[model samples]
Target: SQQGEEDPQALSIQEGENATMNCSYKTSINNLQWYRQNSGRGLVHLILIRSNEREKHSGRLRVTLDTSKKSSSLLITASRAADTASYFCATPGTGGFKTIFGAGTRLFVKA
Candidate 1:
């Protein structure tokens, strides 16, 4: 049931610093996706990495997957105040219509 869990429930970083968050899942998955939520708004897809992929990057975001350990990590380089938001990991369900999300890592990028 509980698919993923992200550590250090909250993080605070300087504007130019880097932020790193880790996620661990309980079961096997086809793929894992990371999303960003700005305040109360909807989530925006950040990146997706398949089970076979080791690492993926997008702009200031870098994601790494380790299926053997059932874990993933997201690194945000040169963080900005705009990047201050909650980051969540989602994994599609077996049926594909539903997705499970970790509680999330709340990031605070001080301007």
Candidate 2:
């Protein structure tokens, strides 16, 4: 079953600007996580927000969750050209060891 679906298939922003991405899930989840992929590189865990937690932050990254809405959002502040990459929201899959990922939002930060 599909878990996370990200909005805004793509995004383009200027360096130093903020970038926002949202994700919606079909079923309930124990925890939701966000990740960033810089082109060919692997996914780097950005932040995680548990169902019980309403919001969490790490550096310039902020994550918010609303269990009632089965949704989550990620915000990146002062984004730079290096921030240009694909961002994905993920949830655990049916298999405990596996994870399901959203299609991702491809972000382009212009220098």
Candidate 3:
């Protein structure tokens, strides 16, 4: 019901398979960012794709944004057991001083 809500709250995949997660937000944002956090660890910035850009990639990660639909998706290719973590999608809040994060998707990569 709130902004930056992610779907498929949990996912399990075997090593070497691709994992996908989706997030939907309600607002006009200049950019969207994705982050990964391991259990008991800090969040790591993954990627920040702008509103004007449709797609961006970093390493084995791919991010796609659709301003029209106010949605974004993250794809991890060739997932490894080490990649098991919680992924979150973030967007800047009013005045750009705050960041709203989605509930996050928990990924379990089995070896």
Candidate 4:
């Protein structure tokens, strides 16, 4: 059972613009994380925002959490063609030490 579910199933943006993706979950979570995956490759951890934290930033990525709403968002600034990939939200759940991922948002940054 996937813990998080992402919105806007797909996205297309011009390079240098910003891309934002959202996730919503069901159940109480201790932490939420965002990840990026290039085609035919493994996911790369982008950022982790805890339930107690509202916002966090790393490089061009910004993550925000609102446990009250069971929602989170990831913002990527100055997007590039290289940023073309699928983004997913993850949560560790009762799935027995497994992390479940939401249906990803496929982003295409047009050059």
**Tens-digit per-residue lDDT, 8-78, candidate 3:** 89999999999999999999999999999999999999999999999999999999999999999999999
RMSD of each: 0.8, 1.0, 1.1, 1.1
Cα lDDT tens digits, model 4, 2-109, are 778999899999999999999999999989989999999999998998889999999999999999999999999999999999999999878558788999999999
All candidates' TM-scores? 0.96, 0.95, 0.97, 0.96
Model 3 stretches with alpha carbons more than 4 Å out: none
Candidate 4 lDDT at 19 equals: 97
Worst 10 residues of 4 by lDDT: 91-100
TM-score of 2: 0.95
So what's the TM-score on candidate 3? Answer: 0.97
In candidate 3, clashing pairs total 0
lDDT of 3 at 111: 100
Global CA lDDT of candidate 4, please?
0.94
Which model is ahead, 1 or 2, in terms of TM-score? 1
RMSD from true fold, candidate 4:
1.1
